[model samples]
Target: MANLGLLIIRLVVGLTFVGHGAQKLFGWFGGTGVTKTGEWLESIGIKPGGTIWAICAGLFELVGGLLFSAGVLTPIGAALITIIMIDAIVSVHGRNGYWLTNNGFEYNFVLIAVVIGVALIGPGDYVLFYRP
Candidate 1:
């Protein structure tokens, strides 16, 4: 049952990240694609926020999400997610306070906590590969 709970968390969060990566990289799922996303990043003062950075962010999300969902290299997956979330908080959400209602860092903080908690807790029994 505990493993089941972990699996459920992994699937939901990981797949959601995969979708977000797809949106940024391929413009699928109503995403703005690399160019537009880059433009947005530039607008946000991410300096050199162009194709390269966009690709990097997309790969991090896609690959990290994949590893996380598959429960392979769980630590690395968690690290990647953590890095992205930290970047998000620093670059985008740290302002406007801690509430999501004001476009704050609330959601990103929760994600960070979740990934970190899962990392500390271990990916559990229902994983594709287990490394402790």
Candidate 2:
């Protein structure tokens, strides 16, 4: 039951990130693709946001989400999620206060906490791979 809960959490969060990454990288899922994503990043003051940053972020989200969902190298996956979410908080949400309605860091913070908690708790017994 506990493992089932972990699996559900991992799948939901990880797949959502994967979709977001696809949006940024390939324009799938209604995303504007790399060029537009880069433009948005640049607008947010992330330099070289046109392509390089977009690719980097997309890879981070895509690969990290994959690893997280698969329960492989869970620490690395959690670290990636943490880094990206922190960037989001610093780059965009920090100024909006704590409510999502205000475009704040609340959602990012919850994600960070969830990933960190899962990492600490171990990916559980239902993982695709177990690192002994």
Model-by-model lDDT, in order? Answer: 0.87, 0.90
| lDDT per residue (tens digit) for residues 1-132 in model 1 | 999999999989888888888998999999999999888888888887467778888888888898888887877888988898888999888977899999999999999899889988988888986545
Among these predictions, the greatest lDDT belongs to: 2
Candidate 2: TM-score?
Answer: 0.95
Candidate 1 lDDT for residue 71 = 82
lDDT at 22, model 2: 93
User: After superposing candidate 2, which stretches have Cα over 4 Å from the reference?
Assistant: 130-132
True-structure RMSD, every candidate: 1.5, 1.3
- List candidate 1 stretches off by more than 4 Å: 130-132
Per-structure clash totals for the candidates:
0, 0
Per-residue accuracy of model 2 over 1-132 as CA lDDT, tens digit each: 998999999999988888888999999999989999999999878885458889888889998899899888888888998899998999899999989999999999999999999999988887887656
Our tally of clashes for model 2 stands at 0
| Residue 45 in model 2: lDDT | 82
